[model samples]
Target: MLTVSNLYVQYGERILLDRISFMVGDRERIGLVGRNGAGKSTLLKIIAGAQSPDEGIITRPGSSTLGFLHQEMNLPKGKTVLEETLTAFEETNKLEERLEVVHREVATRTDFESDGYMNLLTEMSDLEHRFHLLGGGNKQVEAEKVLKGLGFKDADFQRLTDEFSGGWQMRIELAKMLLQKPDFLLLDEPTNHLDIESIIWLEGFLETCESSVIVISHDKMFLDNVTKRTVEIELGKVYDYKASYSGYIEMREERREKMAAAYSNQQKVVVQMERTIKRFMAKATKTSMAQSMQKRLNKIDRIELDDEDTAVMNIRFPVPPRAGQVVIDVRNLTKKYGGLTVLSGVDFKMDRGDRVAFVGQNGQGKTTLARILVHQLPPTAGEMKPGHNVHIGYYAQNQAATLQPNLTLLETMELHSPPEMRTRLRSILGAFLFSGEDHDKKVSVLSGGERARLALACLLLKPINLLVLDEPTNHLDMLSK
Candidate 1:
């Protein structure tokens, strides 16, 4: 079991976590959830030993191990996908090599009564046992199995890791983490880079895996499928429920309702006490009685309802200028890099005001098509024509990463916005849940979800009728998604 006691975390004046305490039972699957900037990722980093808490202690068995997969990871460039994943079994590989050495020593020694010969034989036996227990014989098969489960193909296994995009590299990292099979798994936004089928595969994989998992994901269905418990962080406090995401949502609502009711009742009592105190104060003979009552009222602990943000983003695209009926037309579109063809003779048309979605597994050219639509890439052959007066607002998968790290949130938005938008910038940010001191926060300090929201907020400053979003909801919370 993993236990967190009196955990405290603070950034500047904001108390991200306030003396929170929780426990993860053996083999438990927990869904760590909260809105953007609620410190869900921070908590995961703390548990993974990547970050330190301001105050608190985490206790677990000395032999227990942890594997963490976060958004940002630097993968070795020269290694192939399979080879990189097999690095998880480095200890096993070393043990196997040592076992071979000891086996050879035992075979060559002819002195049956010598202590050295007998010791060599015993060492080989122990090494063999350790290697078998670590699944040394099946390391390659295990690596392939995990890679395939995460949407990798058998053909792609031999491809260089650096040849793939960031999303594919992230999958490689996840495969390594899964292969390690640590006692505790801390995954932050694990579904962000996964396709629908891969997400399903991962759900089944986690359900059967022996490792206890604490996953932070915005995908509600994924959480519901994989997690057995939900831990929510809100207003620097935590609410734990022995239920999945769907059940936790219902239980949280019930808790909020109870808090509201108690707050209402307390308000009534507070009002009554104030009224009685005022009446007694009006009489000179009862001044002492009023003072006593006022002291009692001051000592009363006021009930507070849980504060939840229910604000909805109101987004309206700008009217498209007069244009031809055909918003976009493509014929025999083909794209190739070297000998590999990502898109082959793709043909499609979109009329004005029509919405279309390109869905496929990673590396299947979904993003390539989006980029092509926005004129970001040139097709090797065929044609893509846009209607007259067509204006496009594109949000790339790496839009948040493209933001200037040194600029404050408001400044970043101001740079992208038109002069007319400047007047309503705060309101626009408010719609996207950035307000008050949030505007002053530097982009570098924002979490993935917050940066995504800020990036999206910038796009809305001057929208076009044709809005092309690639993996737009990857980093957003459920409400924002």
Candidate 2:
């Protein structure tokens, strides 16, 4: 079992985690959920011993081993995929070598009854046991099995690590960790770059893995399929729920209802006590009762409801004059870079009010088509036409770079908004959960979520009949998405 007690973590003056505690049983699978900056990653780092908390005790059995996978890590280049995967057996390989040395010495000895001989034989037996336990007998076969399970082909196993992209390199690192077979695994956003098929394969692998797992993921379906429990971090505290993602949502709603009811009851009691004290202050006998009631009210513990932070992006584009039925029509669209073809004569159409989601592999040209539709990039050889009265509002995935970094939140909105809509800027900002000091913050200082919200706010300043959004939910939280 692994346990955390009274964990506290702070970043300068800001408290990220406060007195949080939880436990994981031997084979438990836990899913950690929270907003982007709610310390989900920080907690995983602390558990992995990569970062120390301000005050806490993490206890695990001395015999346990841990494996951690972070989003960013320096992986050794110029190594083949097979060579990298085989490195997990380095210690076992050394043990096998030592066992070979012991066997040779034993064979050369003429006297089998000698004390030293007996000792050497016993040590050799122990080494053989451990070697088999570590899969030294079939290490290469096991490594290939793990590689294939992670979507790597046998033909690609000998390819150099540097030949692969960053995302594929991350998968190599993950493959190595999975092969290690540690007692516990700490995974942070393991499904970030995975395709739908790869993600399903990984989820199945994790489900049957022997190690205990604690993963932080934004994919609700993944969590629901893999984890048996949900651990929620909110407002610098942890709430443990012994159920899957859907069940946890039900329990959270029930908790909120109970809290609301308790608060209402307490308010009624306080009001009645105040009225009694005001009406009977002059009567000596009743004055004591009123004083007792006042003291009881003062000592009562108040029920504080969990404050839900609204999404900082409330995007509602102003409606432009109605457009024709067909907003965008594309035909025989083909895109290529030198010898690599991204899209090949793909044809699609978008109506005025269609909310379409393009799903495919990372490099399959979804974003490329979005850019082409918005006129940001011209297609290699195709025609795209907008219907009558169609006005487009384009949102790029990297809006943080597109928005003016020097402008404050208030200024960015005002610059794009018309004079008549300027008066409603504060209300619009409030809808996006930006108010008072938040509006004064510069775009450069905002987080990814904040930048995305500001960019969406800019879109709402103009009238648009069609919205071409490219991964608009990339930086958004679960609720925001």
Name the candidate that leads on lDDT.
1
* lDDT for each residue of candidate 1 in 351-458, tens digit (9 for 90 to 100): 987989888778889898899999999999989998877889899988998999999988998999999778888888887887777889899888899899888889
> Candidate 2 lDDT, tens digit per residue, 269-340?
888888988877878878888888788889989888887744445556576889999998999988886677
lDDT (0 to 1) per candidate: 0.88, 0.82
Clashing pairs for predicted structure model 2, backbone only:
none
**TM-score for each prediction?**
0.88, 0.74
C-alpha RMSD for every candidate: 3.9, 5.3
Q: Give lDDT: candidate 2, residue 399.
A: 62
